[model samples]
Target: MYAVDSPPTPARSPQTPPAQHAKPVRRRSQREARVAWLLSLPTLVILIAMLAYPLYRMIVLSFQNMRLKELFSGATPPWAGFDQYTKALTDGVFWGVVGRTAAFTVVSVSLSVLAGLGIALLMRRVHSKVRIFMMVAMMFVWALPQLVAAQSFRWLTDSDFGVLNYVLTKLGLDYATHSWFVNPWEGWTVITVLVVWAGIPFLAISLSAGLTQVPKELLEAATVDGATPWQALRNITLPILKPLLTIVTTLSVIWNFGLFTQNWALRDGHPEPVYQTLATFSYTQAFGRSNYSYGSAIAVITVLLMLGVMIFYIRQMFKIGEVD
Candidate 1:
């Protein structure tokens, strides 16, 4: 070999990895992902148990001819397919109840929001002590259970011994012992009032929070620009409050649309089928008539409606983000 001095070969090092021998970055990322999922496993399990499981069961029940007798006899409830859904969708009474529910929700939500807005505005203008009292009163009412509130309505409207009847009698309305439930208007009025009252505190508190975010400078500037308070509210306050309004009203619709405890409790004393809202109607079919599948179908429809509200709420949140 021509001893042409080959350049001294560089020493191979143990510390530095060659390009082909590099650590697996993707492997590390996958491991981190697995660790994160493991950490969240408990919450995932809870949600599956509480929310997902029931939803799955309901959907299953809605498609099958479920009955208490079938379960007790250990007999399989056959797949009814769309029979329950067909019945629910075709029933004139069901459709009427749905119409009433929509009207009820509209009235209750509108009045509650308006009342809350009024209260919020008044609180802003009132002395601190008066504002505190109003807030406390609203909170106290909100703290009452819906069942208890419904019972209170019953007591207040009792034909024989109601406080309201007593007051009306004292005011010289001789027919003050009114069978309130007999009249659709009166029964719905009580329900509407209950829903409105129940909804006001949340709406008021939220609107107050919205109010805080509204710059005083804007109001003052509007006044400087010769805008009346009403005009300023119509133009500036409402535009700024659109997001809050959308959220509150949508939530209220969801809550009121599916109201069960209060509606059931209020009508328990009488049990009028005509007085049924969608929630009570579902209850009637499920337990009252032992038609579980049909009830579940109704429940599925209600869930779909609420899901629409949820989707609306999420879209609104995204829109707000884009605006910001």
Candidate 2:
């Protein structure tokens, strides 16, 4: 057998130098990293300047004996250690305010979430036009300035010459123009109403969006399997909506916990403190009484409470993600 000479082995094109091949890729990666950092720079600067600095200052101030006088006089106050914290913790009014604030948060958030869920469910079944109208109405109330709404509601609920009393009398209801601020429960009721009104829109919008994301196919399949409407909602829709619910509820807790404007406006020039939420107490300590150190202590406590709540919420969110 004549062995045909093997065709000349194809000459391999000289491989591009490894450095040449890698250079462009390394340069491109560097360029991408630079671009990402450039895009993040503004947010980083703002957070450091606005959030970090203030937090640092607050922590420093909390440990000092600083007052408005010292601040204005530019004198660095001597450190007071944990005295301020101890005082705040031991104060009767402080503890009382804490309880009131807790009650306010729980009642208002619960009512708002319940109300929002009902409204969202109703809107889901309604015509798009009607849903839009209701959404706009809720948004209008939500978008109103907090101070403006507080003042307006204060006027409406006034014991003397108030429209609420007028309407009640007109409707032949027993209407006594008693001072609402004198009664802690009545004052809380008004505060709760204002908070619920402001809060419901957020929950409604969030829950509505969540509801919209519930797959029609899943519901249909559930129905095909003889599941009731309620069963389908509980098993499928609720599970899907949990993340949104957690987000809305956590946000509502934070917002309501820091409530000050409504409580202040609702006080309406009353001399005796009626509804003293934690925020109001902090404000009273800081500006009203010029006790900056004490105010900082209260603020720090409030911050810790909020942090705890957020941590719990984050844990729940991760737990939900892990659930099958």
Candidate 3:
């Protein structure tokens, strides 16, 4: 047996699965990617044509003196070389407009989000029938066109024959034939009220939807542990709702900061310089005064401000995703 024994046959290295086996999978993935791109192509094209081109044109216009003359004559606008920006930056009135816009955004968004959160919490505690009715009413308001709402508010606040003044007069507050717009403060109050009223439905509904995701079990356990409703909300429910709250808050900020319809409508399509926001201010400069390049520059700045808000929103969303 020893004489017959031979060196053990060299062990064969383990054969790898053939690389050929991966080729079809790789090809399929490539094919799927191609299909996905194809599916997205139309949307990409539309966005580029609609958003990108207009943005590019606006940017160019911001750097050029393009008034009605240039616009109508189809002539190339003279290069402005930062003059428009300088003018905007130097103008105290422009700064005032910016400040007013920021202030309104803060006040309106704060009121909206707080009121919305309260309403959402209330909805949770209400009978199902009541909840449904509230939702129906809010949905009706939300669906009402902004223009119509603004017009209705205008009518309600009208000086000569306003129901508001009539009611206040009836209550002996001496509001008979009171002009709401005489004082900028009063005008702004009306505008803010209308904006807040219009905005609440969206925020409440969205926050209510978010609240449904809060775990009943967790809330029950917290209750069992003798945690107060506030403590439970602050600790448990808020943490769950934080992401949605952030998203809605950011959107509200964006919408309120722009602030066109309510202010414009309330002011009768011609907001005074005192009531002007960035949006209306730019519009007044461009169309009302025919200072196109200056208006474009302001518009550019507005877009940048919005971009900052969007960046913050995106960062919050990313953080929320990581937490999830």
- Tell me, by lDDT, which candidate is best: 3
Question: What is the model-wide C-alpha lDDT for candidate 3?
Answer: 0.91
Model 1: residues with Cα > 4 Å off, grouped in runs: 1-48, 321-324
Against the true structure, what is each candidate's TM-score?
Answer: 0.84, 0.81, 0.85
* Candidate-wise lDDT, in order: 0.85, 0.85, 0.91
Writing each residue's lDDT as its tens digit, candidate 3 over 160-221 gives 88889989988889897899998998998999999899899999999999999999999999
lDDT of 1: 0.85
Residue pairs with clashing backbones, model 1: none
Query: Cα RMSD (Å) between model 1 and the true structure?
Result: 9.9
TM-score of 2: 0.81
Rank candidates, lDDT, best first.
Answer: 3, 1, 2
Ranking by TM-score: 3, 1, 2
Q: Which candidate ranks first by TM-score, i.e. highest?
A: 3
**Worst 10-residue stretch by lDDT in candidate 2?**
315-324
Please give the distance, in angstroms, between residue 84's alpha carbon in candidate 2 and its true position after superposition.
0.5
